[model samples]
Target chain A: MAVINNKNGLRIEKADITLGFIPLTDCAPLVIAHEKGYFRNEGLNVTLSREASWAGIRDKVGLGILDGAQMLASIPVASRLGIGGPKIDMISAMVLDLNGNAITVNNDLYEHLYAIDPRSEFSPLIAAQALQCVIEENKRSKRPKLRFGVVYPCSTQSYELRYWLASAGIDPDRDIEIVVIPPPKMVTAMTDGDIHGFCVGEPWNTLAVQQQLGHVVATKYQLWNNSPEKVFAVSESWANENPVTHQAILRALLKACIWLDKKENRKTTAKMISQAPYIALPEETVALSLQGLSLKHHGQLPEKVEDFHVFHRYSANFPWLNHAEWFISQMYRWGQLTTPINIEETVAAVYKPALFRIAAAAIGLESPSIDRKTEGNLHEKNMLMKSQHIGPNQFLDGQVISVGGIIKYLEQQSLSKADIPALRLINIQKEA
Target chain B: MKVLLIDIDDTRANKLEPILAWTGIELIKLNNHNTDIYQLVGEMHPEIILVDTNSPNRDTLEHLAQLNKASPRTVIKLGNARSESINRLAADAGISIYAIDNIPTKLLQSLIDITLSYFYSIEHLRSEIQSLKPEIDARQVLNNAKKFITETYGLTEEQATDLLSKNANRQGRTITEVARQLVETGSFI
Candidate 1:
């Protein structure tokens, strides 16, 4: 039921909307759309709400107090599966940004890991292995389990933190206590000795390093190259009702993402998002990662790691169904989601690739013809030139999840609690 | 039954304290934002916890509800069973409710209705006072304008009122507007 304005040649179901966002650097898409008049250009009045927590954003969006929000990539899927929270039918049509999170450990823990293996600072896997040795020694001496922090129970940071630990044979649940801390409180918690390490989105990691409170042990990009991070999500009911307005928002975000990805605009973005109403951190702290510099250690020069915070390149905005499957796989592996479900059908319901295609096509961009693709197969050499439909998708442990092979991938994961046979039965039933 | 209120204003909490106390509901108010929510919730084990919807501590509480059975989980279904009431609770009251499992929806609804009416009454009085403020100010302006008219033109109070009414009727404006104009500008065109 879209009512068109003949004068403007655009029809918006709901013109005035309030969208929620945490004060993170990746919230640039929503902020840019609002600040740069992209929303106004589309004849939409969008008020960007600076939310306090992911749970606040999730609940507000669920209750329709928010029209939509920038959310963790796993939220819509997790909410749909009723894992880690109440069941809420949510969907995401666009990925906001990719690989903006990092795992940081307190200076004392970092020193312990570094003493075991000097290369821990350079390699995520080696850092995990070194941390494993430290964990073993602590257990032998009857020390308490190391506590880690994440932004949410079902966030991508939680999954990434677990995946990094499991790479070195450390069980996240059994070996360490993972606590949920608000992103802004993460550095304070680390300083107060409450959490030894945390995996969160920037610029908290940057702030911790600047304060000499922590050292970056592993980054999300190193865990899985260019993996999906934050996404623009809305409740399924809201999308169904405001189809036209949703499309308009998607268009505005896409344009903003394109403008953000250019190398020259990175500094301006850092400065813009660092304002009082946005991330509110110093521009230099937010500028490091946005400018492709990965600061892993204190009293050292930051490493040049391009793609540290990918906004648009490499078909990053496409809501890949396989990416949704990966989050579900982690949920199952961690025992956060136990009930068997049709993996393909579930991912399709949560990630709207068809809607993404419509939005992409209207902007004269080419989306991948297929909804799902094999992850962790493409490397840097293969993606040297500009690619319209693919990007670097390699994992830290060299694990590749071929299309429709999520169950097989989960079966091979270390410390997995997934019942592969039951999952297969559900998938087979769906196909039949 | 124990209920914890986090970040509610002191005056409102004080008003709510005795009202809830009469029903044997012990209310513990947590005003410090720096308090460790997990440790407090673990120790207090309150059946129902009320907090602002936008509080930064809500996420840590959500994590606690996910990991610990003793902690109160969010009351999502209350918003679902009767959305209108829940919307008013969130939008007007700006509060979110979390309660342990098996708390009946009817009980929660009644609690919400009580809280809503309490806030509504306070809000009702505040708004009533708010609406009356302009009238009081206008009366002052009218009196000052009458005095100005009497002192400058040697007109009677009735004559001043008649002149203001005439100007208001001619300009199709409120008498207050004409009176304010004369009081501020010392002239009514």
Candidate 2:
């Protein structure tokens, strides 16, 4: 029962590790890290298995069923705090990618966003405004406010959607209701009119726009440039026993990042990720700009270079404590979990910079010079999210009380039957 | 308070003998296949209703939704649906809650009391506090049926719940009864 630390743990470089990944667009680096022979190059043996759900991914890692897996950035924070289901100490050795997520309004909503704004000129911020406006306008028309979807409760997709919506003066809870939907079904849900819109990660976002079921109103990276998204994660115990293996995997994955980010590899990577076995998306839907260039949205080259998914280059491989803590701050803000924790120590423990540094130095790259200071622009002064009424920059994480009493507080906010019409709609609709 | 316990398996009545031991309530178990359980639920007007998960006999939650309008006094307990994520997600999406088996004796009674007291009222909510004296306990059973269907079949919350309801009803038993049918019969369908 002694505390876990580096003193007596098994070195990661000495062990072979099994990594888990889901077949999403961003799992590319982890898969590519293995495919490109980076693991072998770094003196590590790695195995990759595709998982079904984020819960399965978390549980397998928690129970030591798998060594580690690709995880949403919020997962490590949520798992340690024991938020979503159970608490198992997990850590991130490196960020998998950023951006590549967008809020797609259903076709009806997209058309309204375009037609209603007198200045039909597109802005994620305006589309955000339009979404809020439509909800309010619907209230006047007595139509039910929209119910939007996010992939999971503990995800950047939910937070970013809330952040993006709030920036536009929309109340995420009141103006619209947010629920979880699996990523693969998001576009179909939008097309079927089961949900008004959704915030999800890659290929799906691309799917919505291409199918004309929805439009990408906001990219997570644009809302907050280089915002931390997914991570390559492992359980604390696994990391402890397999330190050498962990470091080797990180080094290998870092090399894969470098290779994936290159212009020549970008096209091949897009085609590979889009295959039926991966995201099950058509290659045309996932076609990243063949030139390894930036995305063109609304006839504009997004001013943010980090708006698309980033595998290698920059400080991508160096797991930042700030990046991890920022999500804690967000979890606190969104009331996902209660109370603020010792952000510095917890984030530091979870980010696993020691392993990251070892991996980086092994790959002949300089580690990030910034050791502790926060990165990225937390201040979204220029952005307009859909749920703006919940904001005005005061308590941005929307955390008033600390994380200590979160469940009780958030439970109090649970919707009553009167708040939204009871789900007897099936019966009512069945009769009607 | 009185509870109407409807099970396709007659033995559950024997198993539940201890559950209704101390409470100021009467437990009535109807395991017969031909019983008009839904009509009886409305007629008897029990404070809480417990139906077998396998009842091809009834869509208990769906019936609860309907009963809530005519007789808001009756609250139905979908006790066996808490085993899986798809079930949990389905319950959460449907704005209801279920209690799966294997809960501790105390917690199980507390869950029964919560349903007996009705969830929305200040009085039932008042009972919720006393039941957890030291501190509030928030624990729900891990619905295996939910986990089984979601992981094995990749079914959504709505789909999994619907499939369970349909199969159970078609077999003319409770959902728990039908679930066991699935398990005992040993075919995934």
Candidate 3:
């Protein structure tokens, strides 16, 4: 029964908070939050319901099977906008991590890029352009579009890579393609050259760079500089009914994020995330991943590290409305939003910034990037929105442009017989 | 039509049915040979697809990934987000984050709305393609007719179209049928 003022009383006291999470290194927050008495601190019992795919999480959440989850920042935006599937209203409460993802090109392509340019230097923007040039040149000789991999469609990596390439003037739809590959299989998949590169989080990016199979072309930090990565999202009703419980959970998580940011706690926190039940890779793998953040042994550009994944930096925890606006812009730019959106109201409704502020105040936490309106231009080369800014134009950079209605723009250039970019899979395997 | 459970029965499964009912979600079950996961994906193309995390099926995640592209806007369901094993599988499949249930119905709808809002573009893209097929086909036929006129009348392609348009007006019939009649019957009908 729906909760009324004082008569029906909410069942949240006994309600289950079935959280879902993917197994990537970034999933550590959910694990740490739950494992470290975070959920209990909030007088709540949350079942850490691990899931199969971004699809699975969405479905379970839609049908009320699971409550909320650690989701791709775009997932909430996509779900609410209903671009990938049926419109499912969702939102991100907290910005989990940042700058964990990277673009890893396969060895053959890496060598091929070098062979063509002969200057295997450290310019991701130029390399991206060079890669596009190679794809275009090869197109004349019947070279099929090379496949690149991202974790999911509703992932920042997908948009980032697309945005990155588009800024360099490469059409993601027609030029180098992106396919979704799980992090575990990313390296092996890259080896086959079935996928030329992949954009993924943590150990995987470190894994690729360490193996020398590929190099990091760009970090997500370069894409949007502290863009929301992932979040522990639940249904809005759940939070509304269980206000104190929600605050408690946030308080617990507040501790985790604080611990994660500490220089002394990094080793222990990394160890915890790399646990057998967690990211279960070798300690060395986890160490390498953590080391890659600061160390430059793996060809990772140190310059990108300054604005890398700041766990508690710059209001990362604050689910600001402007941040919502930024994502909405991205949704429109990427053809994720089909209809006209009430971006302002939608942002207010989707983002629980007020709740976040309350939690931040309770926890006595200070967020970096005090102003969410700072319009920051991404370092990657996504110029389709040359004059489009994904977020509010509040950053110091005048280069920021609005991503308003870029989908309509891409559609105008790429309308189908049906007047929309209707994508069909290249392979329709027979039911064998 | 009831929403298919897409999995076998158990306590959790049985409880799921009523819970969904309470939440105003009426889904059915199709755990039999009639379970043409592919054909159903093509025809029925359910709004939501629920798959078990433990099922030994050929990476249903992969299948759903492909289906996501084909089905256009259908959602594929999994149990929870904490299932890292399954989450990895789903991520690799190109599915969007439609729903992640662990909170309450409000959060679920928030996620759903997010999914719906996000999917609108791609789904609209699908509808756009679906709606314009006939027009495109007609245009193609019109082009073919224009080409035929270019060869027969020894006129340029542009001149042939202009000639066809003028003649079709004189015939008092549709240009497409007139163009077809001219090409096939070798005379204007």
Candidate number achieving the greatest TM-score relative to the actual structure = 1
Give each candidate's interface RMSD in Å: 1.0, 12.8, 6.5
In order, the Cα lDDT scores of the candidates are 0.89, 0.60, 0.59
The Cα error of candidate 1 at residue A60, in Å, is: 0.9
Sort all candidates by DockQ, best to worst: 1, 3, 2
lDDT of 1 by residue, A1-432 (tens): 334442236578888899999999999999888989988888788899999988889888988999999999999998998776678899999999999999999999999999999999899999999999999999999999999999999999999999999999999999999999989889999989999999999999999999999899999999999999999999999999998889999999999999998889999999999999989989999999999999999999999988899888888999999999999999999988888899888998999999988888888888889887889998876777857456688899999988888888899998998999999888863211
Residue-level lDDT tens digits of model 2 in A71-172: 988888877876654467888878877656777776677778888783423467777777777878899999977878776667788878887787677767
- Candidates in order, TM-scores: namely 0.89, 0.60, 0.63
Best by the lDDT measure: 1
lDDT string, candidate 2, B13-132, tens digits: 444445465556687767774444445665776654455432333323332332244332212222323223323222222111222223343554465444433323445567777987
Please give the distance, in angstroms, between residue A123's alpha carbon in candidate 1 and its true position after superposition. 0.7
CA error at residue A311 for candidate 2, angstroms: 1.5
Question: With candidate 1 superimposed using the best TM-score fit, by how many Å does residue A62's alpha carbon deviate from the native?
Answer: 1.1
Q: Give the per-residue lDDT of model 3 (tens digit) for A1-432.
A: 332232123233433467777767677667777878766655567788656567667665755567677788767776676665546666556767665777777767777777766553455676777787788788989888888877766677777777667666777767776666656666777766657888887778777767777777666765566677787676666666567656666676777776665556656667877877667776666654444363222554444253344566555666756566666555655555546555555666777776777677776665433324534544334534422123222221224433333223234332122223322122122222
Cα deviation at A276, candidate 3, in Å, is 2.0
Which residue segments of model 2 deviate by more than 4 Å? A1-16, A43-45, A118-121, A289-307, A374-432, B1-102, B105-189
